[model samples]
Target: MAELQIAEIPYEDGGIRYRYARRLSEDGTRWIRDGRFTAYHPNGAIASEGTYSDGIEQGLWRDYHDNGRIAAEGQYDRGQESGVWRYWDSDGRDVNG
Candidate 1:
């Protein structure tokens, strides 16, 4: 099996600033970035994922719990939350809107 590929930039405070990953294409090409961005938790679980434009977060972004369940989900405009947002518990129950 082929291993997944990821490229990451770190913040000055030792957190991730941005990250990009390789994904297989419809035509079988390996592409990096491809619009989706991800950050990892200290335990290596996905902390958040969303689209970016010019280094700013855009579109839908989802944050996850340490147990791997979605904790919150919402849309973003230039790294700011925009539109209606929702929150969920680790058991997948909607806790907020």
Candidate 2:
């Protein structure tokens, strides 16, 4: 698996300066295996986390609410939904119960 290097791009929201790790989706598939991809909210919390295979999502992927809660978790096979799915609310509570 290739290592991830995060960098910040500057922007402004309500005059409060902030930075976000840029969107990292690319088409290269030769380097990353068992890879982890992450995105963050402007408030500095987790926005999403997932694994990829040859550039296609092939495992459990979790997406968070802006409030740092898990909004969804599910399995993917070659980018298509392919298993049990769980969703959560903004408080990190599972909604699939």
Candidate 3:
């Protein structure tokens, strides 16, 4: 049995700034996302955060505005959006209502 090795990759978009950091695991065949994932805004603020299982999104996920306020949040099941999702404005006010 081959031990799964995790790799951390930091990516930059257009050579401007860091875009996202992803963790991938090799399953003896191919590399797939299998851990925490975080994306950043061009200004360095976190744009989104979530987790993945075998390249499929799973569990809670949150997206933020460039100003650092929560923009949206919800759950993911097998890479599909699940349950009720909440949204907020850049000022942090809930936009669902």
Which candidate number has the best lDDT? 1
lDDT tens digits by residue: candidate 3, 4-91? 4444345455422323323434445555666677777777788888888767989999999999999999999999999999999999
How would you order the candidates by TM-score, starting with the best?
Answer: 3, 1, 2
Clashing residue pairs in candidate 1 (N, C-alpha, C atoms within 3 angstroms): none
Overall local distance difference test of candidate 1: 0.76
> Residue 10 in candidate 2 has what lDDT?
38
Number of colliding residue pairs in each model? 0, 0, 0
Q: Name the lDDT value of residue 58 in candidate 3.
A: 96
CA lDDT of each candidate?
0.76, 0.65, 0.75
Give the TM-score (vs. native) of candidate 1. Answer: 0.62
- Tens digits of per-residue lDDT, candidate 2, 1-97, equal 3455444433356322222222333655333334566666777677777776655777888888878767998899998998888887787666786
Candidate that beats the other on TM-score, 1 or 3, i.e. the better one: 3
Model 2 off-target regions past 4 Å?
Answer: 1-34
Best by TM-score: 3
